[model samples]
Target: MFSIPLVILVPSAYGRMLLRLANTVKERSDIHLQIFAAGNDWPLEKVKEMTEAGIYKGFKPFEQLKSDFQQADAFLTVMSFEKAEEPFMKTSFTTKWLDYVPYGKPVFVWAPDYSTAYQFAHQHRAGIAVSEDDPVALVKAMIDAASNLETWQAACGGARKAAETVLNAEKIHTLFVDRVNHVCRQSQDTPNIDDLKELAR
Candidate 1:
């Protein structure tokens, strides 16, 4: 197979900024961050120095995005939560989880609430969910997950399992069929307002 030079993990600027916030913790933490950005050239070396002793490597954005999740040994994600008055936080899902599907690597999520991804992770045992401001929690989770190879591999298996539950052509077809059936049922059951008013009067 043709292997590329490197994998580029390209998230939006908002995500990058969120990630930077995690780096505010003391350096030499268990979690190490690698950057692959094509936007304004910030001093990523600062990130490298803070995390992995200046081992900042990269390729293109697309490739890095893949390796960052899939081939990456692990991941740290920033997640939001579902508030009572507010809607579920958008960042709670982190589409990056989709990229990690191929590698089946375990993820360390930094989220503020119990979200869909958090539920998915627990359901499939695919990753560790942490509080967004808890960098210590993220690092500790990453370290523990890394140390347990069997557990990590199982998480990968679980990730693939999660995908199979939703990604198969047959599964999609079944969902479409079910949705159409429900819609048809609803249409049949929808009451005619005018007819009801006339009958009542």
Candidate 2:
């Protein structure tokens, strides 16, 4: 379906408002909403504390990563990939956006100015995004996103098509074969390698 699925990729009590906002988007826009993270990136000591306080939603392991990616028509990453700029960015300097790129999902990042993934997605027709840190802006972006599922799906499809090339098993297999060939060539180059081995024996 062209209708976008809204998936929150961050895990925190601070994210509750976003979760509440997702309910609104679902009612108003027909988008599905869920929660996810690559793993319990949050500290283990805080797990029970967060869940007990109703601050945590759920966690997905690397094995289940593919399903989690598929569950969302869109992914939200709250980190920044920009560094030189300070005031607009504050602290984060990483791309949470990369985690979802393999799924080829549309990404919505509350990111700093230099988000290469956001810019790339914008250029590739993967999804729409917003700047500024206002939570209201996030909700509005969600509303706009609610209707752009068709566009989001197209981008995701393209992303999935390219995932295999980047996660190439055969290319990895070729590397393994090349290593064996290199070792064989080295053995052949060694003069009296077996003779020396026999003398030692």
Candidate 3:
């Protein structure tokens, strides 16, 4: 059986959910998961525990991390599924998404339906979006992506297109300038307090 290599870079605070994901992946034989836990918040003891348990492959240095991502078959990014995190999840986009876009690999977005990551994945068709909180659902998404080579290739192409079009630096700069000019025009068109008072009289 051929195993698909999936790489994920973990931020400091998301370890709890990450552990759940790791454990779930461990039970599966088709997906080989490698996690790079980045930042100081991940305690050394906890890292050792997960490593010994075979769920974690240990922290990779900066250079090796880039190499691993380049070699991996696919990428994964996640947002918190908790209700308390809804506001942040909906409004903010993770830099991980941007990083994965350049890799030209399929991304598995495990997040709530309302999350920005989920919406972006759906809009671009660049990856599989699993809005369910279940780890099983995430694993199923991985299997589906690995099994369908045609769809996988299409997703890879979509990612590259997204980078060239919507995420392009020049396009973003122009959009920002246009927004600022529109705001200035709206401010100029609004009536002043003195104008309103005179009209009232």
Query: lDDT: which candidate is best?
Result: 3
| Candidate 1 lDDT, 117-172, residue by residue in tens | 66667766666777555555656666676788786787667767756775344676
Model 1 lDDT at residue 150: 81
Name the Cα RMSD for model 1.
6.2
Candidate 3's residue-wise lDDT over 1-201, tens digit each? 233333455554366677777768765677777676543245677667667755576556666667777787888888888888889999988666666677787878888999998998898786688988888888877787778999889878887887788766678789999999999999999999899999999
Q: Which stretches of candidate 1 lie over 4 Å from their true place?
A: 1-17, 20-32, 35-64, 67-70, 81-95, 166-173, 188-191
Error of 2 at 122 (Å): 3.2
Q: TM-score for every candidate vs. truth? A: 0.60, 0.48, 0.75
lDDT value, candidate 3, whole model: 0.74
Candidates 1 and 3, the one with greater TM-score: 3
Model 2, 5-120: lDDT tens digits are 33345544325444444434444434444544433445565555445533344655656666656666666655432343444345333344445667666666654445544455
List the lowest-lDDT window of 10 residues for candidate 2: 1-10
Better of 2 and 3 by lDDT: 3
Q: Which 10-residue window of candidate 1 scores lowest in summed lDDT? A: 1-10
Model 2 residue 93 distance off true place after TM-score fit, in angstroms = 7.5
Cand. 2 TM to true fold: 0.48
Model 1 residue 187 CA deviation (Å) reads 1.5
Better of 2 and 3 by TM-score: 3
By lDDT, the candidates rank as 3, 1, 2
